[model samples]
Target: MTSPPRRLPGEGTAHTVEQSAGELARLAMARMDETLGWYRELSAAQRSQVGLVAQAGISQFVEWLRQRERHAPSAISIFANAPQELTRAVSLRHTLDLVRTVVDVVEARATSLAGPGDEQLVLESVLRFSREIAFAAAEVYAGAAEARGAWDARLEALVVDAVLRGEADDSMQSRAAALGWDDVAGVTFVVGRAPLAASSPDAPAATVDSLRRAARHLGVEALAIVQRDRLIAIVGGTRDPLPVVEHVADRFGPGPVVVGPTVPHLFAAGRSARAALSGLTAAVAWPGAPRVVESDELLPERALAGDLPARRRLLDRAHRPLTESAQSSQSPLLETATAYFEHGGSLEASARALFVHPNTVRYRLARITDVTGYDLTRPRDAWAVRVAVTLGRLGGTGATPGPAVGLSDAGQPAPVGRRGLEESSNL
Candidate 1:
């Protein structure tokens, strides 16, 4: 067999450097101090930790050169010898700065330290090592970021759960603050069907991410959770939540999406959550409801479903306002509205029943609409009015069926006519 090939000068120098690894490490550390401002910015403990890392890196480089024929050592593992806490104390950029400084020192000393004709080879190896170190730093930071993101998601889910269960307290607020919810100005809960899991195992998470992305685009804050087949989101930072809801409506699955009224803050978001969840539960009652419907608009359906809060809401928003006006017989707007509805919305019939001209009935209906904010002409508004009237009657308010009133052109009560009495009886 041929005599073993004589070791190259570059190979011999690599062995020499490995024998003096401790000296090379010290030189790298000194250069790090001279070159990097951020290094000096580190605390004493952090700086000592970085020094250990620098030393390990130089020693690892020498070991890799000695074993070059076996296999190149992994540059990433050089950081393994340092305490994991170093990753936190030194940011990726700062870590990269350290790596650059170390590499620069190695490159500058290569000609003097390496055997004849080995300087170029040593410099090339330092370049390769620096590249790998940068990649390793990036991996470390990415992992940390992913871990933080997952923890934040769990905390967000908890906060949403607390709000839904109406158990929001100081601890929940603290958790919310940790998730950066301090700037939220107003809060509203939105509920809709979650995306189907058949499409993807993480479809719920994806849907929530989509909602968050949409909320961000709208310059609002959102915290969402996937509970069974429903996805609920607490949206905040906007007084006018309708536009925000509409902006994010497409993120929810196909169904009626209900938005609760905007509460003043997140702690009061439980009110919005209660209303939104109730609306979502009762949404089936209105099959043709708009894609984005306000929780208050679902009161009639919610009340019909035995929701006491909905019943009270109907009384407050529809029944009480109308009935309060009926306390005075001079304001015949309520009676005219009752006759208008009872007479099948016929202007002529209501006019005849009220003993007034059609124009007078029209004027009274206008006044009623102005007071109640419910236009009698619209079918949905008509349904709300009818439901309110029924609820008022059931509540023993005597606010329904509109007491008969005869009105003259001067807008004061006039004596009832026999014809009007006959027409009223027919109604």
Candidate 2:
């Protein structure tokens, strides 16, 4: 009885908007194609998503008018019907432009689409709805950005793991390409103990993010991750990478932060990774080493700790080149170096032992540096020369007791002790 008594007049503006929804959506799309350059460039599927969004906007405005008295509609729900690819294919700015286009179409047709007394009301409602929808679009984009960031982080970790494991095959390379690391050249690898994060569970990721932000200022590309207690980073520097590494060294944990040599490209970065890993393990031997020392500087410790690559590097750079310099004497510089180190790096003692004058010993020391790049006066350089020369002798003697492998300080034959004998046999 009450329902039949006095039925209020239909909401004219809401009815008109509902009737014109299909046409208004078409007009909005047409206007977008006419005005927005980026919109025209979109693929067919993306364009279809844009159409769905425009149609939804008109329908939502009608619903808002009808249901607003009891429950205000969430303008955000206007985008609920849109596909996920809509957000990815269309940027926030582009989406806002589309929304503005829909609003413009509706406003331009307000006079014709509304009942006589409802035109101004429809126009005002459109203004308010657009403002709310703009905010809703921004919130949607914020969520997309958050999701994209997490996915990119996981992808970066995969690329780094692949590179470190020397699995730089096509599959890994494709993944790197997805991360925009395909064309990068001259990548440097850095290794150190991951910082303790007792105060925060997310310290490692935060530290890595901070490091990457710092590196970006230098125009460097950085990919870093923390694996348990080990922090590994692969840095791509266009200029001298050492300066960038030096600038970022304070970010690492309290331990040796070893930087490896640069390789030609990311595909070849495993070589650098190996060296950095070996240097990090061997760094404990040199308590006085710099916190950000190059892996090459730790060659002596690495070679001594059974890193075959380091041993081969020392032999090739110093022993082989020095021996090659003397075709007749088989590395006379070798004997000069042997005497210098055996006498506690004393030039006079080395001269007395080699039966040469002090000046001749001094001249030979300069030649040693020229041939081997290791200065005998520097303790680290002396350590490297000792290891290289010892490896050279042991490598050459092969199951035979030789004086070269165990030379006394007096430049005479010394006994190959039980330890030396056992060590030499393995070589």
RMSD, every candidate, angstroms: 13.7, 10.0
Predicted structure 2: lDDT: 0.77
lDDT of each: 0.75, 0.77
Residues 248-303, model 1: lDDT tens digits: 88888889999998998888887787778778877888999999999899988877
Instruction: Point out where model 2 deviates above 4 Å.
Output: 1-10, 69-77, 80-82, 116-120, 237-239, 328-331, 355-359, 398-427
lDDT of 1: 0.75
Best model per TM-score: 2
Please give the TM-score that candidate 2 achieves against the real structure: 0.81
How much is 147 displaced in model 1, in angstroms?
2.5
Q: What is the lDDT, from 0 to 100, of the residue 265 in candidate 1?
A: 83
lDDT of 2 at 331: 40
- Give me candidate 1's TM-score against the actual structure: 0.77
lDDT of 2 at 56: 81
Pairs of residues clashing in candidate 2: none
